[model samples]
Target chain A: MSEPDGGTVGKAMTVLDQVANFGRPVRFSELLKDSDFPKATLFRLVQTLTQQRLLTYDNQAQTYLPGLRLVQLAHAAWAQSSLATVAAPYLDELAHKFGEAVHLAQLENGQVLFIDKRQSVYRFDTLAQTGQVAPAYCTGVGKAILAFMAPMERDHALRQQAFVGYTPTTHGAPDSLLQELDAIRASGVAYDREEHERGIISIAAPIMSDDTNVLGAVSIATSTSRHTIESLDRFEAVLRSTAAQIGSAARVWRAPMPANPSYGNSGGENS
Target chain B: MSEPDGGTVGKAMTVLDQVANFGRPVRFSELLKDSDFPKATLFRLVQTLTQQRLLTYDNQAQTYLPGLRLVQLAHAAWAQSSLATVAAPYLDELAHKFGEAVHLAQLENGQVLFIDKRQSVYRFDTLAQTGQVAPAYCTGVGKAILAFMAPMERDHALRQQAFVGYTPTTHGAPDSLLQELDAIRASGVAYDREEHERGIISIAAPIMSDDTNVLGAVSIATSTSRHTIESLDRFEAVLRSTAAQIGSAARVWRAPMPANPSYGNSGGENS
Candidate 1:
């Protein structure tokens, strides 16, 4: 919270996330509104991050966003992170079995970075913007992974977090969220319960790493209008089984699937 | 080719490829053998890149590879490069229809970047290593795209190029490569013919931007033992139609897939 050295890199990272999280190139004013940073600080952060190739700018549009450098970096990290590949078959299977959208995302700085997504053939508004960020407390996949974090860390995250109530029921309290996470950890499943958006529910479970760190979470997102909670419970079983299978796969040969997971200080790979 | 500043970025990128292409972290000595640079200068470059987070260093192993920052960069690039997302449904349809590996790659700086890939349900070797680079003259997808390049640029890429003859059947002659491109252009399809590998055969078509610039190429790779040219042709109609579908998507979207169609690219999202 204190900065005089400019925290050049951290500031740049902040600007990058704002854009990366925006799901599209963001205008400078949009940056200020989203990050709640001072206008001048946001400007310098954008400019420097752009100069570093950590962020790229489209001059004509006067917008800022993550640059090619991040793609290059993500590719390299993916080789080390095996979640992307490990979850592919499972996500594919989930998509096929459920005829709905399946996705894998990691909690980064308290938001979801969708690493990979599979669309349903059924054609629904379930289309997710891969690499887009959403509040960690509202989505099943995010809560599933967050449930595994240390109690202290989870509390800290909840305290400092700014959550948007996409619907009327987005989770907000540390105590209540703790209960949800405990349920996920105990039963090996997490549910959206129409919290993230109206008329949508997702069932999710965490995929672990070799050391049993929650590396990321996988989920099936569908419409609440289409699938009732009882049917969703059945699909939750499927989602949990799929996540477990991916965990075993990740530990076996460590193929490059690259889903960002909450590793419980296992390199802090998660939030 | 020369000293420090001349090929600074190239050598650094080569080290990146060595790690990325192999799907594992590479040792310093192994990297030394893979590149032709003085040890001292290589050390500096690696350190600088690591410092910049363009690359990473594993302290325990003393090996250098791409860092999470690079993955972030790649992800950021994909965030902006909408080509992959736009083309994904088409790749999905192609994979579902053909039940083979589908890859979308772009030529970048005389190499290829495998921006996006989807595999069949059955087992197969991986076709994409997201950021790795390889030769352009000998790959089906490579030639298919190169065939669309401006003549002068294409000729320039071929100059002083050693075709390496991945197989004896590889077209090493500049004349033959030019000839093949012509046929591909005429026929609207390009063939690999076991040029890149003995057991693999592929056919590719280009996805062009609204400006008619070749944004990237897509290919279907299958085993020579199981898939004959005729069999591949059986799927050709769908493949070409799928490619055109992706092309149209790219044009309508104006934003290229969330990936740069880099040169001689290999592997997908496998940092």
Candidate 2:
């Protein structure tokens, strides 16, 4: 067993997570309403976090946001934990070769997190900021990784999906998404047919470890005006080959995966 | 006053910071040598941090590195605290205009921290990675920001410099560096004359808020082989103007700076 007050640290981290969920500066009262802790305890915890620089207080708006130390630490994590570090050359190559925007994404707690991106030398605007998350049910990279996951893990991740309908073509329920996943599994690729946003499309492939475990996904995204769905199919072989190369390179280059102490043997080796 | 046990959280943070300082995975014994904590206390703290996923243990190497959750949190920090968000368009404009590598940097613990970078289309090998740290005395961005800092803050920052000679032209003491900062303050720009590393030369200017407080610094880095120091002077007016635009743009954008409770009234209003 850990220290008696170890749970206090957990509680403090929960508060930190809640603030990050907001994606913008939040007032103390706003945080208080959503947090489970009592007002006095929450106040003390926030004060301590502020003192630690884990949370910064803006005296002007009287709001709290994530601090710079997290950014410094995250840069280290990005260089190590994610595919961004290992796949940089591949991503640069794909971006230059295809002349399309390239995306590198990983699964974090069942959500699709965009870890890195290479903007097309040409300009087109969309909201895929490096840290931003998107629905697993409608995006190409999300579907590609989900298609390759072990059945139990895939089911668990599917259950976490919001299935919010952003466009009329969006998958509004699990059944429709499940049908697509089967096709994706057979083809070893996934497509986004303006399902998340109108006029946006992508072809994604899962990057797999040499052990055949899914590591992450890579995609070439473009506006519908540039390429039709049939034309997009031309990238399938090259896209999958790029993903495989990145995966194989990553497998040989990075450190061995560690077992999750909390999950014991039940947690798979992949995260 | 903060809680007496605030030191407990501080101690835990020290353990976290120690892992980050390594830049790569580190074994427990390696950390122990540099750590002030008793063996047992450090062990308990490491266990707690591992449980929290603030540090991930690589079982194969038996080393610890930063975890994914920290990256997720840092993404939030990078979006808010650093100039990455507000300066994106400005950075893009500068890169296209100068066709040179552009850097956005801020002072962290009296050292220069590169928060964002846009590489030149041409090739040159250098150590300017985003999220990388460098000494304050011999770099362009470092001197640019240092010249604008409040006197006490600047002096404290100066005391932190190692005064290590990286090259024959490098500043080896505070007196010479102080003289350069005076000229920088007057000229509104700073230059790195093959100081930190041979062949790496740059011209930099500080980004200031509407109140004329230094927010960060921006620079155009080039190799001495590519351009002479006098030829680099041609970018001076444009570089300063770009820095001014980013400063003014950052002024209207982002959250208000937080007051450092430790520094009392002397910490100033700009973050």
Candidate 3:
């Protein structure tokens, strides 16, 4: 029910999304290219957002990044979110167990927002910091959660925008993308298969509440050379059990926020 | 030159500050009680911040907390800041070496904004999560940085507010605080002897670049019962060496933005 069109809040979100995509404090000129946002509008939006502390304007770099206020907001959201905190110890254990990087991410606006992660002491990591966002159609955590969304909801989410191919192995075009999501649903697990970044592979499973509401997804990420299909199958069982431990523990902290007309996740206006 | 007086941005920032003071989100009535601001002001401010994605509104909890955008922003800042990346691995090593909590913090609004942390693998931990802010007057990392700030910058910063004491050990008067900072500058390290919290103790070393500009601070935090004065002396040498390694490594990635008149640290106006 929320308008996704360009407005102050929407444009501010777009600028932030650009920063997230690049994982850099993008210069204003660079943001203009992919965004196609008007120059003046972008400036005003960025300025206001910076002033409000929603964005950080680096005087030394002349670039835009999300501000401390933004981090605080994400902390607030995740604080209410059970999966991030409850799974912290589990993530560490899983990473230690597999000697790989394990991540827990939940889907928001059709993308995977990495809430927590633990990397093995000797793993090669591409530096995906916590709170980083990645596309849902390609990554294991993304695909794991995508498999569970109601068909219509999933369709609506995918239809919300175009998918950019991150690597040659990325699945694009709606028809093919939908087929892959369906495959994940059938299997109860998802594989990255180097679709996000070359040489990286991951195996993942979703966690659900006692009521069967999908909570989030967890993954064991590693270089493809280290994990074969058979090896991943063995890891998946551990992943699933680990996710269950997380979900059950999350129950104590992941309480539902009271419904208020003015606040909450961007859903249930219809409800 | 900028007014610190209350306005929309001020209301919004204060709202965030209040939310951070809480362990979790609180109801609007609770926010009113927690803050000196009026009810209507708090409500309107919460809605604006929620809409702008600076704060999250939990209809279920009927309370507001920091939002996802803030987490994204902090992560973004963490990603872009060379200090964070260079020190991350070493921070881990130091934490493992010391078998206690280690933290990296930068000065923001004369307070220590936690940039990163590694908790000791123990059953109990004292300090809060990643985005938690601690007073500069009491904490080791905060004192390390503040004690080194260019004099005028330091004075102007202290002029902006009152010192609300958090603990009996917290320094309440600005003059005593400045004197302590001066003594810390004469020495090379800063120590927090249960000044922030009653049972916690920490030793911090300032991270300085080749040109000796203060980059940030790294500290080893532990329970006083776990460490004695002799142990801290030995630990301080490790902290200083680790900070040097981090400072030097960060130099290779020093793509600092030009100092813009419009952009400034909370302590001083941009040059």
User: Which one is best on TM-score?
Assistant: 2
Stretches of candidate 3 exceeding 4 Å from the true structure: A1-50, A53-66, A255-267, B1-65, B121-124, B160-168, B210-212, B255-271
Instruction: Choose the strongest candidate by DockQ.
Output: 2
| Model 1 chain A weakest 10-residue run by lDDT | A262-271
Span of 10 residues, lowest total lDDT, candidate 1 chain B: B262-271
- Number of clashes recorded per candidate: 57, 0, 24
Q: A129-180, model 1: which lDDT tens digit per residue?
A: 5556667888888898788876666676666556666777887666677777
User: Candidate 2 has which clashing residue pairs, if any?
Assistant: none
Better of 2 and 3 by DockQ: 2
For candidate 1, the lDDT comes to 0.69
Q: How much lDDT does each candidate structure score?
A: 0.69, 0.83, 0.74
For B1-271, candidate 3 gives per-residue lDDT tens digits of 4555343555567777677667576778888888777888677767766776666665645566666655555677667666777888999899889788989988765667787889877646867567667777778898898887777867765764357777787888898888888888887889888888888888998888754478789998888777864578879778889988998887766635344444454543332
Best-to-worst TM-score order: 2, 3, 1
User: Which sequence of candidate numbers ranks them by lDDT, best first?
Assistant: 2, 3, 1
Question: What is the lDDT for A51 in model 3?
Answer: 71
